[model samples]
Target: MSALGMQSSILVGGFQYWDSRRKGRQFPARGDLDPLIDIPRLVPHIILIDVRHDPLDFRFRLIGSAVRRNLARDYVGHWFSEFPNYSASSNIWPRHCAVAESGRPMLQRPTYVGPNKDFIYVENILLPLSVDNPGWSMQMMFLEFISKRH
Candidate 1:
């Protein structure tokens, strides 16, 4: 069960759309993602992550406008592990690993720790992405960070 207070229909809808694309496969590929240009309201809240491995890294691929503003910074091109959320032994790390390993979606509540240890209560969803010829290099993923703050 999710610890989130109230779910956003937009987030739920986006997950459903991505889930639908799987069609019994491991996960939805990047090519299968919708443009999201159709939903202007959601554009600023969505985030995309790349599930990289070797040491199991999660890279920030896209940091939406609203999230960027809420976070007071953008992390695109940066590694999720650098942040407190994905730090070793953190609740979020294991759940994210589960999603990467099982190729399933996981909804988890994690307190995001920014620089200076500022904590933001957030609900995050993790999804896998793969290509026909699945490999780490092509293993993209999705993550939605819905902050309860602000």
Candidate 2:
């Protein structure tokens, strides 16, 4: 396997272990993921969403600086649809929605086209979060770039 593929596998494995340990409970809320508090062994890019709203209403509640540099622009309050054509936003949106609705973790290995048509491999994890809200419409997504060498 390629280096990116290997790294992606490791990340997926880690997420799987974490998921298994959760034992069907919902992921913690945004405040629970505070930088000063939550320290992940692998510093992946984290994103939170509120599925109660429109899919187009999804936002990035958290993102690491390293991940931010690879993205086209700031995505703090923007929907996934706001991403440029190079970003493969459309392909990933549906999967994200499914993960939110099912309240399950979804892992994806997608080739993202960055600025100037540069290609980068990204391993993303969409973990469902069940807040006190009625419909279990909250979710937290974590993205870890395998590497930028490719």
Candidate 3:
């Protein structure tokens, strides 16, 4: 619900949709999310990540069209550590780790440093998805682009 403070309606709607799916649980189950029926408009900006333990790695489960276009590549089956042009020091890796460990939602505005330099910034929200698990196993990310570099 705190996502209301966000300037982007898409993010707000996405968060609200996620909140609605909780249904008294700490987090929603990944299977409960039906983007096509519920938040169709937000699908283009959505990304699904699978949280891997052991060494605490993250793998892309799904990537929306807008995200693929922005990155200029499709990373559906790639790990975060293998992101092109990004080293292990990338902030995204740690952020995903924190969300998985904390079982909490995170809203962030990160400077655009991806393959698409034309982007100025990105406003995104990461929501944890748990299914009868002690910790989150999956995460749903909704990103909203702010401005252009020009």
lDDT on C-alpha atoms for all candidate structures:
0.62, 0.58, 0.81
Return the lDDT, model 1, position 119: 45
| Clash total of candidate 3 | 0
Error of 2 at 40 (Å): 5.0
Ten-residue segment with the worst summed lDDT in candidate 3?
A: 83-92
- TM-score for predicted model 2 compared with the true structure: 0.67
The TM-score of candidate 3 is: 0.87
Q: Write the per-residue lDDT of candidate 2 for residues 1-150, one digit (tens) a residue.
A: 132243554455446544554555655453334433444644455555665443234556566665778777777766555665413356776776777667567767788756635456777766766556554355655566654564
Estimated TM-score per prediction? Answer: 0.72, 0.67, 0.87
Encode model 1's per-residue lDDT on 22-104: one tens digit a residue. Answer: 88886767777664654456667677777667777877788667667656467899876797755656776677677778876
Off by over 4 Å in 2: 1-35, 40-44, 54-56, 81-89, 116-119, 147-150
TM value for model 1 = 0.72
lDDT of 1: 0.62
Separately for all candidates shown, the number of backbone clashes (residues 3 or more apart, or on different chains) is: 0, 0, 0
1-150 in candidate 3: lDDT tens per residue? 653367678788888899899998888898888998888888999999887776677788898888778875778998887874433587677788788888888888888766766678899899999755543388999998776743
Candidate with the larger lDDT of 2 and 3: 3
